[model samples]
Target chain A: MELTRHYLIRRFREYYHKAKIYEPIEFRMREWAFVPLKNFPDFVMVRHVSFSEMEELREFLISNVPAHVYFSSAYYLKPSAEMDEKGWTGADLIFDIDYDHLPTKSLESAKREVFKLLRILEKDFGIDEKEIEVCFSGNRGYHVHVYDERFRELGNMERREIVDYLTLRGFKLKGTQFDRVCKIIHRYVRDGKVNVDEKTGEILRSSLNEIRKGRLDLIPPEVREELIERCLKKLVVHVDPPVTADVKRLIRLPNSLHGKTGFRVVLIDLNDLESFNPYVDAVAFGDESVKVRLLKKVRVNFGGERYILERGRHSLPEYLAVFLMCRGVALYGH
Target chain B: MRRPFLPILPYLERYPFLKIGSKLFKFSKDEVLSNVEKARDFVEKVLEDKVEFDFKPIDFLCSNCGIREECEGYEGCSYNISSAEYHLKLSRAKKAVLNWLRCKVVVSNLDEFLRRRFAVKLARLYRDLILKECDDFILFMADDFGLNHEGFSIHVADYLKYAVRMKSDDWKLVNRFLSKGYVDLSRNEFVRLMEKVIKEILMEKVQINLNVRLKVDFKRKELERLPLKVECFPECMKSILSDLNEGKNVPHTGRFAIASFLINIGYDVENVVDVFRNAPDFDEDKTRYQVEHIAGLRGKGERYVAPSCETMKSWGLCVWSCEVDHPIKFYRRCLSGGDKGKRSSKRKGDSQDYA
Candidate 1:
């Protein structure tokens, strides 16, 4: 009999019971094919049970394998409400530990940091070197396998207590704690003792500083407020000087109320068209032809957009005003 | 023994004919003037001042005369005697003046016209022959003047050979016309043909020589010193570099073979060279060897030997060596029976697609 069957049951209970001792309700074991573990036993058998009876199963597995082992829940847990309804699956036991996610840029330095973390686990947490196995999960993470068999018959509550004890003793869940641990490992790897080049050294140092300052998370509230002020100043630079006051007032108003009631109005002079038309040889008939040609050229270069053309009267001042308005709209509108 | 009065004799002879013709036709002064004007106009326009007049009417008549010993055509005839006697009677200064005057007007005009239309020296020779009035010399001058000129006739054979080599229809036509002399060639006609042939040959020679020189320069200056960064053993790079330096002659011959091969496969020379230039770590010797070998293979009706991975690895230094997405992948395909024929066929297809 291989150790993983008993070891797996103990690990399952440790997370569930949140205690080191309990009574068993039921226990059943099934023979499985021999799947070679990288750093553990050659074969693995599995035990199945209800959540209530998980403690005794843990006790039973624990006694069989006294070697140090790693454990996790068989299902992923998320903070969202929609995820809570779905019961956990056994696949969650395979937590991915990505060494590359270390805040450093140099791959070699990052890998060394991962080794340092593993060394801590081996020496401080009493994890067995022989029982540990590393796997590339084909993405960003690595799967560290521990096949030590112990507390195989422990009840769920008892197993949970052991996990609680370990948690308190500094073993972390997958969040900020995990992120910190990864950073520490990466730091040791990036120490100047390695044969890394100067460029890699600079990148590693910069990345470490970023992690330390927690800049990886969202920008702080104060920073966000400053950014908004900067954006307003940029907008002010682009606005016309004549409309600067109105634009500033518009910018100060909230978006919802401003959209409901327009805040800024632009008035353009339209008297130039009277003299301009004669210079351009644009009579009423020729006006249409010139307009068509101009529109075609515009379409060729700038494409067309839908706009409401407000034609007041056929007077020169009205035409000039309309032309100015069209120019403004073409310059600024979508 | 008396002065021959040659000017008055010609006038007298012409007067009798003029009088008889006027009587027979009963032409008025207006009609006569019109007739003279019309004749002069026709002569000026049609002949372009190139016609010759017969001054020795007695000699002309005697040459056509049937009597033996008295006719110019007869051996030791009286025509020669009359010509000698006529020549002896003229003052030396008068004869010199007449010859000088003829040379200035007739000979100079013919020479200028021939020079403009034909070649330089031949026109000068034609002028000389006209001035000398040596009929025997004129025929020889004509033979040696244009396309049939003594030294230039060899170009006809050379052009024929070149046409056969190039397999061009225009060149073939030129070759055929020149070799057989089938076209009716006057001095001017021959000169035009010769000029055309010379121009074409000069142009083609210039183009080919430029192409060859550029290809050689590219191989020597640019392609040979490619920056090849091999992640493999340093020995491989060393050996490759050695092989390239040792087989340096390959690019020279290879340029010709490769250009010919590309042209045969319907690629322009520039495109082929450009493709070769941009190919990564392209082994000039190997590429040249392969192209030449493949062309030979094609000639022999044998299958083209696809390049190996090593060959392609060398080729992959330049970006445009092959069409595969990756250099390694291209090498793999080349190793795994990638069709040389298909690649060439694809190039033809691509050219058509672009067109």
Candidate 2:
């Protein structure tokens, strides 16, 4: 099943609560390294999700597990521990997604669908593709992993934004969940004033066929361009404010503490929400404004004086926490 | 016998000749003798007494005698007594005169005659000695006198001309002297000189036999006549012929040449033996075989076919160069009498021609 924002949030809460109460989530600073796990059964087996309910279970496994998770066809899969042991870092990861799979195939159909989802996370939710790595699992699935530094301090709401972003993109579970994901993405576009022309509508009707037949290029360039532009415009205006607000809001949670200073203070303003959604042509400006307002409010309340509003979903929280810690707010205690 | 005038008596005895000549001429004997003695002594001393005893025998003449007037032309003459030694000296004087006469008579026309007869010989001997004992001398002269080989040769020739200018009829006696001191020539040099003389004599218009004894102690055939033409066939062929004549192994050159000659005569190689025997120099079967082999005409049998024009072409010779009209002619004309089926059937057909 397509993971709902509620389900993703629940999983994140579980992990966050567990980390807060039971275990001191060991913070290890590491540089990036990628070791490709292609042709390995371990990588293949990790992506196998059979039932619709498994979506929740998969999200939980990905978010909570401290182990390195790799998409099947990902060119690299080095863990932090691997980097630590080797004492070397700095490698690029090249993921080969299996577009033959249904979920991935859906994502490829109507460039707007995937673009739309990416726009929600990136522009609306302030998530970057860099922070969230994605690949098509070699079998019949797509794998999205949030490897952003913000994930260490991720609360329920920030995790929800990631799921909502993926779901909006075209990720779906088995059978009925695919229809739900499609409906949700369709509704999101409709509400956001995303324009779908007659040709694009026709293409959408035949999208599954095109994807199944492995002819994703069948969509004309003009149509793909229009959809991507429109979706990007929508996301650019809609997602940033909310993502910023949500990041600020999540920082107020007891678990989201500054490591140095014991104080909990937010420094960003919701009035600056319009500044975050700088794209004037975006179709989902209202949604972006709302997100920005929420993020600004959270920043003002929880982000301390030293916090600087950096670009991207993953870094905003880390930067805020670091800023608060620099201002003498101890993250562990507060 | 008074002790008186003892010194005066000795002086008087010492001056006896002077006293006698002075008294005979009249006047105070002592004064006259002194004046006459001074004049005579001055005359004798100036005339010939100045001749050193070490003067050569050729310069000898009786200087104290009244023969001084006749010795006008005999100054430094070998007959001069002052130049000669005593009793043993007289013998030496006689020997010196004889030697001088011999040198005069022997060496007068000696150089001219010997040069006319053995100029080249002497020149060659001189050159050989210059080359042998005088290698350092030759090198020094070549460097110091700026002489190249030609210049050195010219210098040697000039020396020879000078040496041979001496008049000597008896070469043996002249050679004896030359052996002692003059030439310094070695035996090899003498032989070379002889060879040069022989060569020169050969070049002369006069008929002469070169039957000289060689220094190498080997018997040499007398060269009785000039303009001998030496035949030089290929060494291999000559060896073959020599071997055949001497009943020794015949060489391949003779065999190959004879075989090739037979083939060139338009005879099939099968008839090589017959053709070889017909060759002008052929005398026996062995000689014939050798000739045939040398001619490259040896065959397996009488009926054996010669190689075709094409076969010859394949062997890197032009087909047109072969005598046969066609390749098959060798088999049909040459080997017809042999076993009919002995050759391959393929060779009997046009296929062999194509191949």
Candidate 3:
């Protein structure tokens, strides 16, 4: 059994009828896009549409029942028009932390990166947490957006430089940032943590200031790159740079359903993200019985219940069935 | 035309590269050149190889201006601009003598060229002054740049723009100096960077009004026209071209990348512009301007390379998980190896749809 397109559409329509779409700040200026239930699993976007009011958008979503909904990170004068004519004003600075790009491929790792990114932004860039919006991307990531007015006007090069800073792409031992790195290595050396050769060991052990003008270069290229890589693993964040750089990118709208998991793209407060469980909190369906035949053995602890499903037809909770069906692991049963 | 006695003439005769902010006394170039004696005399010092970089740029420390080593920080920034101004005139005179030393033509054999590298000392002199100009003299240079000296830092955006032409890898924001939305600079570091910026600005601005032809080696145009092996074109470019061929609305960054890449690879403006015609929003006027600008034929004359693979990926424009880290290398690898071209050409349509 496979997930039928009709059942998926019906479920999506049901969710949209009650789903409260979190409209972007400048709702009128943003170009909206949606992947309709045209071809299942493979979403082809039909974009260059704009709405004047939130109510109109809500009505369209409820009736049309798009599989995935999105709004432009940018605000344009003629958002509904062709690309050239759509006069771009400014855009929200978005840092999309997909799990695929992180040091570890897990939602928790992505969340930790979110915290790391925020800390870096606050300490280095002087951005306050209040001005940023953090949202669970409903699949395997989080989208942290900077909506401060000054950041809106930053062009591609400036944005890319900021990305370079976060990723520590061009970091060399010369600045205040590297001074901190030097001091850390110095402390580690003094404390008998890291071993080194005589010449390099002497430089590290001598003084922090000496290490600043130090012979880190005396270390081999593999060792130096490995050290940088380790630093990257610790301090650098793996934000999808293109997402931040693309001023007119269409991001997943908050409070909308993800086509892959039938999970809500829920917004979370910055200070209150530690307790969020996407499997439980982001679940949009409840415990009503629904027939689904598993195409493969699935093991997932979803919504606080462990379901070890084998390849066969089974009557499962509506939430589990929808999750499995949306995941393309299960289908509408006979 | 009557020649006017310009108040800034003395200043100009000193530091030819120094910018004076006044149109108070307007004079024509013809009127200035009407006195051919002054022009010849001005140009002669350069011809004789008399311009030397020495104590002239640094003697502004003053007889009793009270600029101690400790005072070199922001505390000493206020040490008598008037006192320094007069001393600055002397330095300007020396710089103007050096700066306007514009046209001493030298034709030499390679051994002679190597032996008589007269510019080496002048360059080292500038570099040393850049490093050691920690006192009021360097502060005057910063003032000329019109940098905001409020709390000893410039905004990140303000500084990153100029950081492009910086010579050292140290000037990169990722290296250090970025903090709290501003790029913090120590006084010496600030002076060093401004000196580098001044060097570039001088090179860009100090074009002589006179045009005298001199023999120089020029590459023939025919050599650049040899067509690239068509099959060796990278997949990412083909993907972008295919999108444009179907009249897709490519983003502005994508357009810039493709245009700059093509121009760098010796594609002419007309052919480049033609390639962009398949764009849905293509306006010939806009396209030409954009194409010519990237080709470095107009506006700043600063040619751009196609962005690195990292940058291309950041723009979401990478169509392949290519082995090489640069698009140019991708093409080069195809040229050198020739195996990747065929295999990648048979790629599924789905992966090629990067737009």
Candidate 2 CAPRI assessment class: incorrect
* Root-mean-square deviation of every model: 43.1, 54.1, 10.9
Estimate, for each residue in A208-283, the C-alpha lDDT of model 2 and write its tens digit. Answer: 5443333325545575456444433343212222222122111111122121222221111223322322122111
Give the Cα-based TM-score of candidate 3 against the true structure: 0.62
**Which structure among the candidates has the greatest TM-score?**
3
| DockQ of candidate 2 compared with the true complex | 0.00
Give me the overall lDDT of model 2.
Answer: 0.30
Lowest-scoring 10 consecutive residues by lDDT in candidate 1 chain B? Answer: B206-215
lDDT, residue A121, model 3 = 81
lDDT minimum window of 10 residues, candidate 3 chain A: A207-216
Q: Which regions in candidate 3 have their CA more than 4 angstroms from the true location?
A: A1-6, A196-229, A301-306, B1-150, B164-168, B186-259, B269-304, B308-355
lDDT of candidate 2 over B47-75, digit per residue (tens): 22231222212211232334445343322
Tell me the DockQ of each model, to 2 decimals. Answer: 0.00, 0.00, 0.30
- Residue A41's C-alpha lDDT in candidate 1? 27
Q: For candidate 1, what is the DockQ? A: 0.00
- TM-score of every model versus the real structure: 0.15, 0.14, 0.62
Top DockQ model: 3
* Model 1 TM-score, 2 decimals: 0.15
lDDT of model 3 at residue A25? 88
TM-score on B-chain, cand. 2: 0.15
